[model samples]
Target: MVLPIVKLVILLARQITRPVVHRLGALAKRNRTFRSVIVPIGQGYHSMNFTSQSRLFGVDTQTQAEPLSTDEAMNLGSKLLGEVLVYGVSASFLLYEYHKSSRKEKIKAKNRQNEKAELQGKIQEYWDVTEAEIALLKRKIFELEVKNHS
Candidate 1:
């Protein structure tokens, strides 16, 4: 029946289009780029009770434990601080570079747009002049015909 044929056509169309659509969506999502900082915090602190404050990738993580000695807490704090500083600095540099590149691209795009607009205007002016010249020639031809007829 025609209905079956139509259904088969529709199914085939969907199968043909689905992968292309999915790929385009993935590409679009990939193009939306952003810089993020990821710091790995181990599970050791989760099981322990200690009052320690440390910075991790520009984030402050505090855990409170009454049983841990001062020396032990200081050691852990120093380790965490070192890790955080290293990761944070790297993240900052990466973010700075990304922003710099984005700015440069924007400036380049603006310049290109300006150039395109100027070129378009010039083309339009050229067309206008050509049209006027054609109109003038047609008018002259009409005048000549009138004179010949007289």
Candidate 2:
């Protein structure tokens, strides 16, 4: 259930971010400064992907930085925006589910209270009937005793 909802939220976020990603690509193509900044970040990302991450081997590898292609910049932008959107959507969904569950629990508690009240009323009625029968029997016994003694 949670997995499907999360998948749906991610898909929706991706769809919503598509236009913005395209715009970022266009901006990267037109702007040299933007490319300079974004490309280095992309280069760092690329180096991390290609390079060995283990430091225990004491392997010191130097990575060459390359300019990011427009497509790469656009993809990076898309990923960033998509993740943010997904987080926001997922959080909102969780909060809504929490509130819904809270309401259901409250309703369940109220029902339990009602049932308890009804049972209490029934028990009180039974005790009342028992007391009334005891009183009548005692009076009959007293009258029979008085007749015999007389």
Off by over 4 Å in 2: 1-74
Spell out the clash pairs found in candidate 1.
49-65, 50-64, 50-65, 51-65
Per residue, candidate 1 scores C-alpha lDDT tens digits across 1-150 of 999987886576556555544453344334432101111121244223222333424433554433434334333433444445555665787799999999999999999999999999999999999999999999999999999999
RMSD of 2: 5.3
Predicted structure with the largest lDDT when compared to the true one: 2
Can you write out model 2's per-residue Cα lDDT over 62-87, one digit (the tens) per residue?
64435556567546744554456667
TM-score, every prediction = 0.52, 0.55
